[model samples]
Each structure stands twice: as structure tokens, then as C-alpha cells.
Target: VALNQQPRDMIDLHARMFKKHGITTIRNFDALNDLRNLSYSGERIAEAGLHHQIVITIMDLPPGCEGAHTQEDYSKMLKDILDSDIPFHSVCFKDSSGTVHPRKVYETIQAARKMVPEDMILHLHTHDTAGIGISQYLAAIEAGITRIDLAMSPVSGGTAQPDILSMWHAMKGTDYTLDIDPLKYIKVEEVFEEAMGDYFIPPESRMVSPLIPFSPMPGGALTANTMMMRDTGTLHLYPKVIKEMEEVIRVGGFGTSVTPVSQFYFQQAYLNATQGRWEKINPQYGNMVLGYFGRTPAKPDPEIVKLASEQLDKPVFNEDPLDILEDGRPAAEKKLQENGLAVNDENVFIASSCESKGIDFLLGKAKENIRRKSTEAAKAEKIVAPTTVASADSVMGLREYTITVEGKAYQVQVAEGGGNPIVSTPVPAQKASAPAVAVKVVEAPTPGNILRLEVKAGDQVIANQTLLVMEAMKMESEVKAPAAGTVVDLHVSDGDTVQAGTPLLSLSS
Candidate 1:
């Protein structure tokens, strides 16, 4: 629906292609917001003779209601789908934020089982964001949910799904028993733990966070936003951003804070905190308010809608937004050809669906430029033989002395026969002087790969303008200008690895 150009034929093609690849099932969520699109996709999946599972993500917070419908509303929506002859194979309750209480899970599932057909399968998918996902799954199972999703120990917990081993242990000697070897899973856990190494987030840190119920930011977005704020030296303002997020969700109409919706809320909150409330609204948020994305779960505040409409200079679109888009396949093919790329149906489709630069990099048409410098020290070894050989008539004695210079030790040997003293060469030290003009060196704030350069040598820039973007610890950080100046030198290129305090560029007034 975001693309707005392709019709149901695209869905048909996708389903058939997946079926050709030996895929038998497809799962989806967020159908209420895009019921028309999802229903169309479901029809195509049914036509392709594949099983389709539609997941209803459940959240219980009052503030979260702005972004999602209530459990009863979700049940009604599910009934509508079941009655539509859409050939859905199952219905699932997904707790992406892991914020649903255990009791609520049991009650929600119990209610859903009554609404769903007895023959249809019921599944539960959840995360461990708040560290209660395993209990939630247990509740869901007791409520007649047959399928539950879990992850291995090393990859599970924290922001990820619950551990399969934990579930196995919990279900032991119960009616909901799992038939699996615990020892085999233990081996798998060991292998993955060793493989993940430094990337692993210890289980202890994945414990329940008290702030999640109030903030409701997904794990990935929260970490990314925190890193971004820290990199920009605005971490102190993060609390304000979180407060603004609640306001944004309320005024912007409650869209589920996941994926594109989550991103919209996060961006709007940042803007609201930094640029004043509603001073600058993102075009996507404006469109969302205008009903361009789809019918929001709740109507946006009239004042907010009016403000967005005035900014966009267009009224809210009640009809499907797909009606306004023109087919972009031809243009996509032309663009690929212009770039000297071989255009195929799939390639053109993908190119049209995503940003060109990102697609080019993913396709390896653009290469990453990185330079490696060795920092190893050179070592020299020397051997000296006696200057005079001992004879039968006379014996020569030698003495060895150790001398230290600049903390480095050296060994010297001398003959007792008054041989010239073994003397070492002395080098004069150079004096340091201050430069006439101070050069402002911009250094990296963290170790990361330079993702892109926003400025070049001789480019004039103002204070706080982003000079580059870097990726570190799986988050993108912007390197901004410290003061207004002309870029005198660039020491790193895109994809260069840099450490904290590594000089990246130089600027002069």
C-alpha cells in the first residue's frame, strides 16, 4: 500500500513465486490498518494453495491504545476475516513488545479461541523485551494456543524471543510436553554462543526494564535512538524525547509503534523535542494524518489533522491511497538501464521498491572504500665478536656494561687493554613550537566504519551540520561539525575503520 502502484497481481506473483520456492506457509500481522491490502494478499495466497496465518498483535497499555485497537476490537476484525471466505489457515496473537501481562494473555487467547473455528490453528509469537515472554507463552498454551515461537538460548531473551530450552523445561511432566532432546539443544546453544562471541547480549542484561511500559519503544529503536543521542552529545535530552513520543502517538492518531509506524513516532518525537512542538512535521507523519498510509485505528486530533493538512496543502484522503499512484515499473527499468545495469523483471521490481543507492550497494555495484594501516614496530638484532683473540702468551679480558637511553637499554662490551671506549652516537632532540593558527581536528567519538561522508575538503560548513555518518555497535551515528569553518582536510573516506579520538578531518576558520 505504501508503494500504491502495484495491484493484486503483484500479490499473486509473490505468492506463486514463494510457492515455487517450496514455501508452504506465510504469516502476517497488522491487517486491521491495511485490511484491504491484506485481504487481497490473503486471497492470492489461497489461490496459490498456501496456508496463511494472520497475527493480531496484542498490547494492554492505555497509552498504547492510541496505536492499537482493543482486544474485543481485534476479535471483531478476526471474525470479519473469517466470514469473508479469505481462506486463512490460522489466527495468532503476537506480543512484539512483550508488554502483555500473563493474565491478559490467557484471557485474550481464551476469548479468541471461542471466536475462531475449532479446526483452525492458533499460534503465539512474542518477544522477551520485558523478560516475561516465557510466562506469557505458558499462559497462551493453557488457553489452547497450539503453536508458540521460540529461539535458542544464545539468541533468545533480552530483546529477542524466549529460550526454547526454558520452554522445554517448563513444560516437562505436563500435558503440553515437547518431545525433544535437551542435550542436543544444549550443544546447539554452545555452538551459537561461541559463534556470537562479542555480539552477544548477556541474559542478565535482558531482565525486565521498568521503563518499557511507559516508553513502549521497541528494543531495536530504543538502542538506536540512545546511541544517536549519545553520539550527538544530547543524551541528556532523551527523557524529553520519550515524553514527546507519548504526545506524538496521541496527537498523530494511534498507529501501532512497529516498523514504519514506530519509526514515524520516533522521528516525530525527536523533532518535537529538538525543534519545538509541531514546528516541523515529517512529510510521512503529515501523510499519515491525512489518511495516506491507511485508516488509522483512531481518528487523529482535529487540530493536528488540520495542521498537517494545511502543511501538505491537501485534504485527508478517505479512499485507498493506492488509487493515486502510477505504475512505476517502466521508470524503474529505465533507471537501471541508464545506470548500465542489466534489468530483469525481478531486478526492476526490487529497484522500484527501495532507494536506489541502498539497492546499488546491496547489489555490489558500488564498492566500500577502506584503508588498513599497520602499527607494528620494527626490531633490529646485532651480534659482536671479540676484537682480539686470546693467545697462549697473553689473555685479554672483556667487560660488559648496560646503558639506558630514553628508557631503552643497550649492552656494550670493552676490552681491558685500554681499547677505545665503546661510545654510542647521540642525537639532538627537536624543539616543539605552537602553530600560528589553531587547526580544529574533528575526531571520531566511537570506533566504527565510516558509512558516508557528508562533506569534502574545501567545503564550507556551519556549526552542528552533519559532516559524516558512521555505523558502530549496530547503530548509525552522525558526526557533526563542531564550529563554522571550511573543511581543510579529510583523513578518512567512506568505509574507513576509525577508533575513538582518531582524527577524521581538519577545519579552519
Candidate 2:
């Protein structure tokens, strides 16, 4: 379950619902850092008579010091919960980023097994992002971890959990065996592969990337960033962005690149590349630097911290960051009531936890708007041919007439025996080409939809100035002027589909 993304109240509500459905065990990923907030959640789960487990996400970066520091932190967090009368079933070492080396995984699991009680189960969860998930799992198993998380094929590799079939085969001759049939899983894989044929499935999502260990972008974030870049027509810059991310992660103290931290790193790196270095800092990054998200494995660069602090006025809270946030349920309930929506625990939870647009979609507001727009577009495109009235005379045999229909002149000839009428083809007028001049034609670098037009004809633009924005592969890219000149023509408009090398605009110096 997602602990970092939502509040304790929401989690409690979710736990109650899950318990109603007879779900006895719930594992919370990314749990160690949010202990204070999770304390109430744990109480609720225990109160509901449910088994709870917390997964401490680990990264083996920054080498020796961070591993030890994180292990200590995890030990303290586990001890705190166990001492608090909260009954937890197990603990997990989650290498969600797949950054942990196999040896490190073994060492960490070995240390953790000794630290926890003998009865307490140890679980291992790792992704195949760096293609070392199977090895890591093996290491964890050797270190006494019994429970391991694995996914089926199609959804099983790259950023996702390791493939269960692969692991099962590897363990076929071993004492630690899985009860399963390979054929059943292969059938499921085939169904998913067929179903996802139309969707954008990144190569990294299903294949090994040698660059992942160096880049260290989490699987989820990598997919998201790729789509974002594709939508912006800036997918070509992805490699550069990944390289920039390496430095960002390093300077930002190499915090486990997951969720809130991963997003922070991604946004900062994206802004650094697209705008300027540290020119646009996300507020969360500033909060992180100020110690709002708890302590980093390594301290952030003092220079970065100072710079971000100055920009954000350096608001630092010594205690848990959640202490500063006012409970949002009351406000959410009030807003729902004001909108004539039923003010219940579920609605309030959704309102408080979800974005306004998301709530509107859930309420069918967005869906209704889409249906209305579709209806309008359908009506606009409906073809309506002009109605014509004709009469034929046998004595005249045939007659020819010029008729005006729908403001267009049409020549029609009536012949004997209702023969088909022959119509003249209209010739479109063509204009002479402009005199040869030194002009620059800016073409689209990739296939995408024109998101916005920044300039129009007769407008003066400077070299490197953004001429327009295009979205491709789920990313946005800025189309810039090739040379300083007066805009002569625009070949594309907002929302127009374009192809690579398609002329977007023209300028004459």
C-alpha cells in the first residue's frame, strides 16, 4: 500500500475497507521515513485486527556510509513500532529502484534478520530496472529472507517487479520451491501482451538497460518522464536529462530515488535542463533541502541548500513535517457539501486526498464535458448534400441547366432515359511563388502535435527564441527560431498534427 502519497486518515479508511473485504495482511512500502504519520495508521490497522508490515526502501548508492546509516535508521524505526504495542507481522527490505548491488542486499538482509525477532518474517522486494533483481533476490534468500515479491511476464521486467516464472525456474531444483505451473503463467502473459498492443510500452519497461545503474531513475519515474518528454516533443533530450539526473541525485545527497524524493529529483533535473541550472526550483526540493522530508542519507550540498533556502525563505521545521499541516477532512467535507455532494467519509477522503480535476472526473463532470464536445464535433462534421429538384420532358429529349446550390454553381445535364449526368471538375486557382529570398524554414524535429504557436506572420523574432511548442511521445519540446528574422509564414497551428521535417514556420532575414 502507498503510505507516502496519502494521509493516515485515508490509510485508516482504506484499511477498514480492506478488512471488510477480508484482506488480513497489508504491506506498506516506503514506510520507514514517515513513522510519525504511520503511527496512527498502524494503530488503526491493529485496531481492525489486521496484520501490518512496513517495507524500508533501500538504495546502495553513496557506497558504505549510507547503507549503514539507513540500516540503523530502519532498526530504530522497527524498534519504535515494536516497542509501541503495535503488532506488526513482518519487515521488508525494498530495493524498488534496483540500485542495490547483490552483495549489499545480502549484507543488509543478514544484518536485518539478526536485528528483528526470530518469529518476525523478512521479505524482499526489488524491481528489474537495473536487471539485477533476480540476483538480489537470490542474495536476500541466502541471507534468510523467505518472502519475495515477483510479478508475472509483460508486467514483470524493467521498472516492475522481477518475473516470477524466471525466479521459479531458477529455484526449480532448490529446496525453496514455488507451487505453480509454467503454462498457466505463459497464457496470462500472452493475454496481457495482446491487450497492451496499442499502448506505449517503453523498451526499458520490458528489457534490460545497461545505462539504468548509472542513471538510477526509478522505473515508474523513468516511464513517467519519458511520457512527459514525449508529450512535450522533447523525447530527444531524454538521454541528456538522464545524465543531468545523475548529478542532481548525487548533489541532492543520493536519497533513494523513489516517490516524492524521485519526483523532486526529476522535476529539479527537468527544470535545470529546460530552463537553467537551479533557475526554477520546485518547492518540495527546497523543503527537502530544509529537512522537511526527514534527514537524507547524506547531507545535501550546502551550496544547493543555501540557494534553495534563500529562494524559499529557508523555512525549516525541526519536528515532523506533518505537524504543520492542518487536518483537511473538515475543509474537504465543507467543499463537498457546498457543491451539493453527499458529505460522507468516503467523499471527504477522496476530496481531501485527490485533486479537484480528479474529483470532477470521478463525479462525471469531465466525462459529460467530453461527451458534449464529441457530440458537437460529430454534428460539425456531418455531411449534408444540397437538395435538388428536377423534371424531364420527353419532347425536349435532353436539357442542360446551371444551378446554384449551397452558394456554389453546378452545371447539370439531363439526358434521355435517366442517364447519369456528367459534371465538370472545378480547377483550384494557384498563385505564383514568391521571389527567391534568403529565408529560413523551421521544421519539426519530431512527429507531434503543435501545442501552441508563439509567433505569427510579420512578427520579429530573434535567433534561438521559441517559435512554438510541440508535444510528441508524451513530452513537450520548444521549437526555436533558427535565425533572427521577421516571421513570413506559419505552416502549423495549435493542435495540428505534424511529422518530422514538416515545415512549421518560415522566416526571412
Candidate 3:
């Protein structure tokens, strides 16, 4: 899969075979700013008696630096694509990695819908790769995406496919038809099992459902899990892919298959990682990593690449290219295999839940059954009927102690305090102490990971000056100084791990 390989070459590629098997309308996970050979491929498709639908979309933003500027740039790009008059049927903003902010998905879809007419599909494809695809899709639909694709639970990964049926049933806003018989779809497993004689699907890969607005069918022949298996040799590729993706985002470069959200997570992880440099990546590294995967990301302008090269260029790199194979180093292959998390099958459906997690839930059901059996056995033991105590105003009764209740613990306590000295009914305890000082003040407008740090500890920054850049779903976001002061306690630095509510940089009050 070299860049210069001809379309005829790709036709022999297994990916094309998947395409030939009733998967004609292949949508990219994300769109590249410069399609290396989309036109050529499209032409080849026509020659091959097939329609090649190449979706042209852009990931949202770079890692750092944000303004009305970045959005205006996206709007202009949309306009340019429209003016090109290329025979593209659709354009969309794909949140494939599920990294888009809910608000951004809403606004971006709304704005794009206004720019494109109904005939040219203005669509959105979000993946719950990071476990948030459903919410982001809901936001996009609310904003407007008439055409969408989802896996039936059988094919859906991470969780079930977007609950399309449930969402449709709940909102009633969309008027779309999948055109598949619901009853027939439900019977697919029986047919498949009959034909195959065995289920390839692990119990963990099975569908779990009704989590969202609507449920799509429980299964389908989709997902890139198989290629992910063949890619076992590219052990270092995952982290490298993450870093390269972030670098692309840093320079406004885009990919058709790698969504802005995916890039956001990749870049965000890269920016926060301890010690990897960009200069280290060369043609050899690219070949080992993305060269086999796809084109190395190119930028909006070559000048951006130059600027990035300046910041990232390092003299003494991590490892020598010649010694790459010799090093018994941090490799994804051994690591992933040791953990048994590396997926090694082409047909394996990565359900929305982890494959093993399904069995764990099943274990709960088994435990519940065991409890039922134990309770049934306990029915043989009877409690003595309560009797009045001889010559006393208060009466004490013997009660049966049954540990078996449905999946929960019994809380035994007397309503009165002090070791049940006085008999009384049990009561729930009042809540614990409240402390004002324990609460941390939240900086509004703070989004995902901090992308860049403009001001360091002890540096004086102005009230409105950018203190740091953060990113959520590939969109560049900013956090500015709250007040004019020398930075005091910089709790979190650039690339430091932090959650949404964690204190980033403490400013003097």
C-alpha cells in the first residue's frame, strides 16, 4: 500500500474485496485535506462497473491556537469544496473517534447543512471508539444529519451500534427507512449458526442494548477488526499513529479515515506523553507505521510543517533505525498479546462492550441463579412464630436470619443507637459532613485536555491572554488567564494528566 500504487493495484487489495461484497458506499472514518488519489480511484471505480463514493470532510482543528479564525477557515474550505464542482455526492464532519464536543457537533452540522443542499449529502459519522458516539450522534441529529449508518448489535462495537431504532422511536424527528425486514433481521443468528456450525462470536462480543434513543439491528458485517489483527507486526504503530495524528492536527492537516475526534484523542494523548519527539519519525518510521496504514499526513501549508519541524526537530533521537529490530523494547505486540487484548481476527465483531466483559455480566446472572437455588433450599428451615415474653410489657421474638436476597446486602441495625440496647426499627443513617474548603472552583469554558501551555509557572500573563490551549473532539479550545498576576501554583503542566474538574493552574485570588 505505497502512495504511488495504482487504483488497479488497490482493486486487488482485500479492502476492495470487502467493497465488492455489497459494501459499495464506503465512507471514510475521516477526510483528508488533500486526497492523494481520490479522483483516480473514482475513475477506476467507474471503469470497474461500480460507483466510488469518496466523502470529502475535514477534521475540525489543530492542537493549539484557536479563534473565530479556525471556524471561518472551515467555512471557507466548505465553500471551496462546493465551488470545485467535483462529482462528490456528500461532504461531512466525521467524529469517528467520538472526540467531538456535543456543542460543536450541533453547531458544525447546523452550519454545514445550511451550506449544502439535500441532494449533496451533508452527513456525520461518529464512532464510540472512546465510548461517546451515541451522545455525539444525537447532538448531530438534533442539528441535522438525515443519512446515517449504524451496525446491528451483532456488528456494533464497544457498545451496541447507535440505538438507531430506539432513537427513532423516541424522538420521532427523523423520516428514514433502513428497508430491511425487522423479523428477518432477528433470525440472522439462527441462519448464520446453521451455516457456520459454530459461533465465531465470543459471548463478550454479543450485543447489549436499548441504551439510547433507538437501537439499530444487533449485528452486521462491518468494522476494521480483521485488519487490526494482521497489523500485529506494527507494534509501535499505535502510539506513533497517535503522535502523527496530533502533529497533523497541530498543522490543520486532515485525513479522510482518521476523524478530527480520533485525531483529538491521539494528539491529546501524544501531547501528554512523557518523552517522544517528532524529529525521530522519518520515512523508515513512516513505512513501519502509517506508510502501510495510509499517507503520512500533509499540512494546510508546507510552512506549517516548517514551523512544526522547528519546534519538534531534535538532534539525538530515541532509537537508531538500523537497531530497530534488535531492541527488546516497548513493543505493542508482546504487550498486547501478553494482556490478550490485541484483537487477532478479521471476522471478530468488536461489540460496544469488551468481549470478556459480556461473560462477566453473565457471571452475575449465574450468581443470581445460585442465590435462587440457595433460597429454595432455605424454605425447608422455618422461623418460630413470635410469642409474648412471660410477664413483660415488651415482647421479644425469634426471627429467621436469611442471607439470601436478590443481589444486594442486608443492612442490620436497630433504630436506637448504642448496640441495640433498646429495641426499635432500623433506620438509614444521615449523610456525612459537608466542607466548603473541600470544593474546588471550576474555570468555565475549560474543555478537554490542555493542548499547549503559553504561560509557565512564575511567568506573568495578562488577564485575557491565552494561558493554555485545550482540545476536545479535534476542535482547538483555549483557556485564558483569569486575572493579571504572576503564575503561582501551576498544579498541572502541559501534557499533564487531568480530569474535567481537576485544578489546572491555581491563580492567586
Candidate 4:
């Protein structure tokens, strides 16, 4: 949607590439549980001779919100996919948020087993975010699921798929058994740990979040959002953003808390906290509520629907999403030709799917900044102690102090004779000064990293025109010109981090 890419061409290109790369199976799913969205993709996957595992997304709605996301709702979804023209070799019950109860997992799979063919496979995938991975998996196995997704240690627990060893141990003393060695997984983990030792793992990615059920954030997206917040110096807003999501989900048609939709909820919640309640509706969220993404399981709240229609300046859409998008292959090829890049199937798909970054890459302007152990150590070594000497006449006994630099706090003890002290001069007091001039400046609405500056010095801008784009809590917001004026000076550049009320640019009326 960001690139306005056509679904048919993108899906066909990806399916052929997967088959060429020796991938035998692909798990296909839509976050909204819209079968119409998956029908064409599944057909293309089969055309490429790949086993397609059609997914039925599942999640538990927040307390006091109902009529959707229940087991019955999922069963109906399963029946729809079976009843549709989509071809698949297996069915997966996917709970991205890891909030579904064990009973629900068993019941959903049990109901699915009855509807699904005996020869076709039934798969289950979930995370351990809420400490329910084992129970949920066990329930699915008891319900006769054929396969479950597992991961190794370090990347295995807390905001990731459940660990192989944990499930292996859990299955012992039961009729079900895993065909694997626990010690082998231990050896594999050792290698993985050494390989990833330099990468900084956010603390939230390593612990169970008790509030997950209430917030219903996906494990896959949890750490990614936190890492971005950390970079923007807005990590403190994480809790507020998560808390605001409860209401976003309550009225967001209860689509399963998975990708695209999950991101929409998070983006909306973050905007509500940083940009005021519903003051800035995330375009993706607005599109979803307006029925651009396909029919949500339930109708979205009427008020929110109206708000989205007004803010996005789009009428409520009721047609299939794929029907509205134009064929993107020709546009992508034209973009490549315009940039003097070769147009091939791969290039067209990349340009269509990746947007501007893909164009930069094709032009050989993309920079590689992969993190390594030595780079991390270099960053730590860059922190230095204060070098400026305190004035001798300023204070007689100020020896201890606490200071924070670059997000790290330190305690320092100043000695009496470290460096040469400058002499102090006293000036006579002056009369009351006149009030300072009231300068007009555009300021950041919240602490965030500047994505780009839309205006330069001496550029004329109209009121409400975007001056820059800022990303805070993983949501992007435009910093608009407060009034029509000529841009006098810019205080920040691309990728600069700023706090709330920091002047982004000065404008002269």
C-alpha cells in the first residue's frame, strides 16, 4: 500500500522467487482474516509448485469487547477459506499476540480438524510472550495438529516463538513425542549465542509482559518498536502507547492482532498519546477502518469510521483491496527507466515493493551499517569524562556531582587540584531589560528522530504544509508549518533526535 503496488504482480513475483530459491512451502495469511485477500496469493503459490499453508488468524479481544475473535469466529473463517477457491495443502491456526487461552487453541484446532481433510496438515504457530506457549502448544497437539513452529535459545523465548527444548521437555511422559535431541539444540544455541553476542537485546524482549493480554501486541513487533523508541529517546512513552492500544483494538473491528493490522493499532495508539487523542489518525489505520483492507470481521465503530473518512478524505471503501490498486509492474519499470536502472523481473518487484530505498539501492547509493561487536565496543569507548575545569571562585566545596550523558548516568568526584582554574570577573547589575522578541518557530510535538526535512532555508511554505517528518514510538507524524511564512533557518537535519518543543525550524511571516 505504501508503494501502491499491484497485488497480482507482487504476489506472482514473490512466489516464483521463493520456488527458485528452493523454498517448498509458504505460510500465507491476511491480518484481517479476509479470505478474499488470500485467494489470489494462494493460487499463485500453487502455480509456482509451492505448498501453501493457508492461515486463519486468531486472537482474544480485550475484556468487555465481544462478538468477534472468538473460536466461533475463527471456525467461520476456516469454513470460508475452505469454501473459497484458494488452494492449500495445510491449515495454520496462528496467534501472533500469544494471548489466546489454551482452551481456545484446543477448541479451534478440534473444530478445524473436523472441517479439514484428513490428508491435509493442521499447523499451529504462537509466541511465548505471555508465558502461555507451552499450554497452547500442548492443547494444539492434543487436538491433533500435525506441526508447530519452534526456535532456539536467546531468540526463542519472550517475544519470539517458543523454545524447542521447552516444548521437547514438556512432551515427555505423554503419548506425544518430539523426534529431536535436547542436547543437540543446546549445542546449536551455543553457536547462535556467540554469533549474536554483540547485538543489543532489549530487556523487554527477554521477559514476560503481564499486560500483553490487555494490550495484545504481537511478539514479532514488540522488540522492534521498543528498539526504535530507544533510538528516538522516546522509550518512556512505551507504556502509554501500549495502554492507549486497548481502545484502538476495542473499536478497530477486532481484526486479529497481527501484522499490518497490529502495526495500525500500535501506530494509532502511539499517535493518540503523542499527537492527542485522534488528532492525527494513522493513514493505514484509517484505511483499514474505512474498509480499504477488506471487510473486517465486525463493523468498526461508527464515530471512528466517520473520523477516518474525514481525516483521510476518503469515502468508506467496500470493494476488494486488490481491485482498487493499479498494476504496479509497469510503474515500477518506468521508475527504473527514469532512474537509468535496468528493468528486470527482480528489479521491477524490488522497486514496486521496497519504494524509495529500492531505488537508492539500484542507484548504488545505499549505505551498509550492519552492527558488530567491535562497533559496539567503539561506541562504549567514545564516552569520556568532563575536561572543562570549574572556576575556582565559583564554589569552595562543590566536590561531588551526578550527571547524565548520552542516556547513561554517572557519578563524579572532583578533586581540588586537577587543572588550571580561570579567574572570575564581576559586572555591575543593569536596569530591567525589554521583553524578548516573539519569534515564530516550528517545534517538535514529541521526542522523536527526524526522518527528513521537507523544507530548506528561504523556502516559502503555506500554513499546515509539512515542514518535516518525525518518527516517535514507531509512528510517523508530520511537523507542519504553523503559519504561512518563509523558512528562515532550520535547527535540525535529517536523522537528528529532538525533544518535545524543540525548535525544528524558524519561520518569518
Best by lDDT: 4
Residue 442 of model 4: what lDDT?
A: 65
Instruction: Kindly list the per-residue Cα lDDT of model 2 for residues 1-509, writing each as its tens digit.
Output: 23124555666777787797789987765412546655666677777878888667677553323333355665665666667665567887767678788887887788788878888899987788888998888888888897998987667878898888898877765668778888898898899877755555666578776676776767777776665554445678777767677767777766777765776776677667766787756556677777776666567788888888887676655576555556666777776877678877667666665535335645766322122322433433211111121221111245556566666555566676777866743322354434656667676654456766889989999988989976543334577876799887776676676645566777888
Tell me the tens digit of each residue's lDDT in model 1 across 1-509.
22223544455656776787798998756522567646777778877888888766565553544445566666766777777766788887766667778987888888888987787799988777777888898888889897898888666777778888998988876788777898999999999887766452433336566555565666555655555444444567768887787788777767666555655677677777866888766556777888877777778889988888886577988987656656666676787877677776555555555434435654686543221122112211121111232221222255545566886556566678688877654333443433545458776654446777989988999998989976643435578887899887777777666544466777777
By TM-score, the better pick of 3 and 4 is: 4
Structural similarity to truth (TM-score) of each candidate: 0.68, 0.68, 0.40, 0.79
lDDT of 3 by residue, 267-318 (tens): 3333333224443222212221322223334423355444444443422222
How does model 3 fare in lDDT? 0.41
User: Looking at model 2, which ten-residue stretch has the lowest summed lDDT?
Assistant: 381-390
Lowest-lDDT window of 10 residues in candidate 1?
375-384
lDDT of 4 by residue, 1-509 (tens): 23232577788898997898799999998888888888998999999999999999988877777868888888988888888888898998889999999999999999999998887899999988998999999999999899998888788888998889999999988899889877888899999998889876667987898889999999877876776666555789999999998999988888888876887888788889877898877777898999998989889999999999998789999988998777788889998999999988878877887655577788887534355655644653111111222321123223445455665545455557775433333222343434543447666655556766888988989988989977654455677876788887777777676655566777777
Candidate 1 regions exceeding 4 Å error are 1-13, 62-68, 172-174, 198-207, 223-238, 365-509
